[model samples]
Target: MLFIQNIYLNKFLIFSSIIYLIYLNNCVYSIFECAPQETATFVRISRARLDGTPLVVSTAGHDLTCSQYCRNNIEPTTGAQRLCASFNFDGRETCYFFDDAAAPSAGQAELNPNPSANNFYYEKTCLPAVNAHEACTYRSFSFERIRKTSLEGFVKKSIQVASREQCLSACLKEKEFICRSVNYNYDTYACEMSIEDRRSKPTHLRMTVDQPVDYFDNNCLNRQNRCSQQGGNLVFVKTTQFEIKYYDHTQSVEPQESNCLQKCLDSLNTFCRSVEFSPNEKNCIVSDEDTFSRADQQGAVQNKDYYEPICVSADLSSSTCRQQAAFNRFIGVSIEGQPVATAQGVTIADCVSLCFQNLNCKSLNFDRTQSTCHIFAVGQANANVKKNPSVDFYEFNCESQFGGMALCTNEGIRFIVNTKEPYTGAIYAAEKFSTCSQVVENAKQISITFPPPNISPNCGTTIKV
Candidate 1:
């Protein structure tokens, strides 16, 4: 116990020393402004390989598990379990963890676990939780039709999910087609996505009443950065410092005010319309309803703050004076630069604002540990760039002439002259390409089929291979 105490004491001393040094020098503080704790997902299965047999599948949280259980334990969400190895495909990165048990029940009666497949496959997903804008956009649902149905568009093939919430989340993660609406069937557990004509007039979507089915519209779904702050700063009121008549409902425990708001917004059980936080007590009280007529729980108030979240009203979303790239930050990615200049005694937002204000500063890194803001002149978007856990990277959301659009170049591409598809970039480019680049591994090339550019110089452009 003494040895353990000493070890902990040493660690604390070292950490405190670093923080003290940073504070004394007015250097960058290595603390993240936002806590984007994503829900980690992983699967535990019965076999090592996909052999046209039913695999016994189980799921465990990223936080609760044995290290050996996960095949790809390096990531927060990964698993393998006792006998199986999680195999990741080369180009697709699909998870295949298992070997055929080949018991007497291999092909006998129907398989216990239904989502059986001959090949290993997993769907890639993109969530709107990456930033504030995406969260705001995806959650802005115009209408939810209970017991309503849409007979148009494709029904998701393969495994049937459990709940409507799960169905909605799955739709949000779709990389292709913008999922405008979803119809969840309780009986079949079928989750169907639609981007059809009904999506045009979402409010006017034709509905056939089906008791077991529920349809929901993605109101502000893909509208990214549709509103600007217009120099209107959000007000954060410190009410806990003074005693007031208090509301009683306790939402959840959070470290900071932002965490409380984020938790409130993302909650599934109850809608969190407002938040009241106590800095001294470290307790967060959330209101599920918008109305504040009832202060159900009161008294014994000690240094708590009440936060009304309607500062940046949704009215700004539809406002015509919205700035295209006013204030935006991609959470996980960091912009690269050598840091031509550095400063101190500023917040991460201030650092971002500094970069946004400068025409020359393309990308910048705000050192959280050192408390220093470093500016960069040029930093192009490179998805393959490695991320440092300690640094907070900010890039100015400049309206790209090409809209930050680039084709992803990958292995095993055959097309050369693509005229029909307006834009066909690489699905996943391993390395950067210069000019209309294509796959040419060694001396051999994809079977070339020559074609001419249509419509004289053509309205847009075409690739000739």
Candidate 2:
């Protein structure tokens, strides 16, 4: 028994000596190591605060302590496990930790830079490879700085660039995609070109306190380019209707097509919905009827094009007007039909205003998920709506008419006219009348025995003076 105990003791000593030597050489203690491995990285922005309800709020001695506290905190509310994504240090004692649920995207947690507030915002970001480090000493680009703000989810392409100017230049020169915004990383020297802007993706504008990055919008896009490229103001379509005459308010000889369009716009006395310019005759006809209000009258005419104001820049507003038209709001409903016109990167208020501004727009369908606006002229019956949680429907309760005044004056004799009905009048090319009384006399000679014409009987009434 004594011999067996001695042998066992010798075996235990040998095992202990081997384990200590291994520990000395590797310099590792349990799962924790003395040397650096992969660790979390954060971007610190001064005088800023990430806007959200804190998931875990506690007092800490330092910002690092607060960061560690957030890293270990499990979401206490939803029972489903979620990790902390951001935190706000008050520059004094309080630390506010936020989970992914509180701020789903970094863009949603946009930092509000307050001049008076002395707070620092931080967010977790992707770390470099193990044992790899970025110098993060790249020169900062100078321009109109929207500090700490990042545009998310609209990146069309990503490339390595030396400076922010090159990034912006790359976006401007991009021919494959319509680049409207750019995100440049100072640490990685990466340029991310985006197809959308803040006006297009307002909600996607997020606070990027997790990485060293800058954002810029392509303000070079002017109003004319906007009107031409995106159908910002006027939209042209083909029509063949040639028999329209009663709706014509005025006709004049124009040297150019642009002059004809300008004449229609300058008509304060009459609401001109469309204009027909004949290149062969240099004849311009301004009318109150468009292809939308009078869809049945549309037909192809030789060497003539029809233009409608889908969106007027002067009249378009991002404000919701409830008094002009009665609208029924369906939060989760979408109208089904071929849209008369569609506009992208607009808000709900803008969509409502667009529908109200258009004479032909009977209803509108807005996609909350995509921030798109759809205008409908016809086919908005009850059966067209479907269940869509991300869509909202609104229908304008009003009659479709170009309600305005008309002025016809000769030798200080002025006559004003107004109508709210479709045109119904016969054209007499052979007869010539000098005055309003002569026209009345001719009408009396032709239909004296007949009762008043029921179709727009009050359209061409005139008084003899």
Candidate 3:
């Protein structure tokens, strides 16, 4: 019995010695692993806060305290933005920074005077192998809200969500249908995904959706070139039905609408003038030849979808695409459309392009807020030209090309014409028509831009897009 007791005592002593040796060698650590990564939210929160605004960021690094991490890392360029690191989910944390036109958002971001030790573990996130921005740029996300929106149709699919961030994760992971827009319902935590072809539909900015739901654009749109697609490459035209007035059908029975359009575009014999799709039998009619004149769309199925590559270059928003300013200075009044060649979302450059593209366009009205381009026939003279508050009427001001009008105008100056971009001073010229025109002749395409206003006449003169 004594020998057995000694053996047991010796084994216990050996174990204690080994542990002490390991401790002396600094091989042990006191640490807490992350409980578990939760979902992440995609809000465009502003950094400017009156008080206690929280910033949520994902960070990770070994032996990193929040204060040390910020000082050693992301400090110089961004300033003392690293206020406090609070865990949200998906390794995201809340930090503070100054704010942007299209900046993202944060919720429950406002910091608390004292965060409970139980609810949050105040530890820095694990750092990526590379820097934060580089890794973040490589990441993709969806624009789902803790809030929600709904529609009977146009929804590609739906996903279950634990939080607003989780729904965004699912939407980002979607494989099919270019997911540009998402509607989130706060009550049900349902995220409805939508793939909108802005070519046929409207940008979410213009879409008047109801409440209890919020709309997010293709997360890429917020980051100019992130997604390869947002605004399309080709010029946009209205969906209409057309009947080939002169050409004979190559196929006795019309082919599918898509096939027909492709056949025309691919035809070696002739350039596809315009495409007319018939929904009744799902047929398409391709024009045999191109018509550079205004009469091309004279008499067709006005009720269905029509598409034409009418621009000098199909790259409508390309920076290198040059445009000419049609009017010198027509302030406040509008020139009507070319009987038929009316277009919405027209910039000054686009206005010039509209007139230059259609042989029939004699005059045009470019609205600042509406971004609309109205091309009209020259024959329709301004016989009874009246002053109107809604538009900037463009007319030839060849006599007094005084660069641009000032705060005051001459008595004969029925309309004030601006040859450049619009500014606050332009608003002062109330009595005169603000004939606004963009310098499209040497229009340089600039890719960087803020999201435009949601109203009509959606195009601005400064940048072509």
Candidate 4:
């Protein structure tokens, strides 16, 4: 028995020594260095008091404490006691454990303060490998709300690139560039990159504001200089034009094409002339004219399609001659099949005003016969009126007729009379019409002098003195 005891003691010593050495190397004192079970549970108590004051018991960082304490002694009521025992602290507040299971109600006291009293509840979650010596803690994070008006400065720049991808890349490389939210095609494509002024942040401003900024430069050249070399050689291209009409009005910028149109359509006082999209960047060249042009050649690339331009014409009568046979009349040109709107009850001035207020109205056609108004919603309506018909009126939508007025007519006619060689005669109607030699002679030579009141119906035939 003694020999067996000695052998057992020796074996035990050797095992203990091995464990001690392993523990010293790994810096572990517990029998099992396993991670704690992830869990979500509440710690509940009844009638918690501090300094004789009724206190509200709360859980914070794996510990239970009183949130509200009084300086004087106060007994907790039954209701307060119930609330204290029913309140629950989310497992996330205590440890890294996430609440994967259904949360318990405050009424369920048994489930509120888990019988196990473990701050953590077991839950399945992905665990990233962590360095043994590093401490684990929650990271502080935040989010920012961005808007269009907040990024006007970065968008106003003239961005030039060989392709849309290059344009996007350039914006990404800019220091203050946040993202491209709005792009206006002013003959050339303008891209707006949004960026927050992080210099306002204390950390960034203190660090460095003059750091070398980086940006991508395509130099407006493609992989090959075919476009520059060709020099306006009828490249089958599509283009876009942006017109800023009203900046603060509901119909300011109007997008005529693409889903990106919605951005301008919803903005105040923004209007876009047209958009031209192509599969190849070499197909189109940005120009100074606010117009989009396309080549006649078809199928230069696959899926390359062009949309017709959306023309806006405010009023047409102001640019045409107005005559009155019975009712007010005006003769204006139309774009062949473009539709027009006409007003009759109102004078030509009022008619034009109405046309300007309508969203879809492009032109006007006023009929003198019935004194009626006709508003053409689309610009593709047929208008073929001839001979200045008494019932027919026409107007054309000029490109420059956006949110402005144009001169239609002037109220005078010039006439010259020549009596002999080296002699000329001119008459100023304003001063001579009332007391001219022809008027006085015609009055004296009249056959019968008619009463002034009777000249209403027979003014031409009857002379009035």
**lDDT to native, each model:** 0.40, 0.53, 0.39, 0.28
lDDT measured at residue 51 in model 3 versus the true structure, 0 to 100: 32
User: How does candidate 1 score on lDDT?
Assistant: 0.40
Tens-place lDDT per residue, model 2, 184-301, is 8878889988766655567888888999777765533332343334535432222222424323435789997667777766653234556777777888776544543354445555
Top candidate when judged by lDDT against the true structure: 2
Candidate 2 clash pair list: 107-206, 239-299, 239-300, 240-299, 240-300, 241-299
Please report the candidate that would top TM-score against the real structure. Answer: 3
Residues 76-102, model 1: lDDT tens digits: 243332332232211112333332222
Give model 4's TM-score versus the native structure. 0.15
Q: Model 4, range 267-287, lDDT digits (tens) per residue? A: 221122222333333222111
Query: What number of clashing residue pairs does each candidate have, in the order they appear?
Result: 26, 6, 55, 33
Better of 2 and 4 by TM-score: 2
If ranked by TM-score, best first, what sequence of candidates would result? 3, 2, 1, 4
Writing each residue's lDDT as its tens digit, candidate 3 over 1-465 gives: 999999999999999999898784342111111122422212321112213333434343211223333323344235454333223221123333211111122322343334322122222222212233321322222221212333335778888775544555454555565565676666678877776522223323333344556655443332222223443333223333444343322331354545655655454322344556665666555442222222332444554455454232212221221222113334456554434467786454455554444444455666666777676655236434446565655442111111211122232222233222322222222232233222223222211111223421223322232
For candidate 3, give the lDDT: 0.39
Q: Candidate 2: misplaced stretches above 4 Å?
A: 1-144, 227-346, 349-465
Candidate 2, lDDT over the whole model: 0.53
Give candidate 3 misplaced runs (Cα > 4 Å): 1-42, 46-50, 53-153, 197-211, 221-231, 234-332, 336-338, 342-359, 366-373, 377-388, 392-465
Candidate 3: worst-modelled 10 consecutive residues by lDDT: 27-36
Over 4 Å off, model 1: 1-181, 184-191, 195-250, 253-255, 262-465
Which of the predicted structures, 1 or 4, would earn the higher lDDT when compared with the native? 1
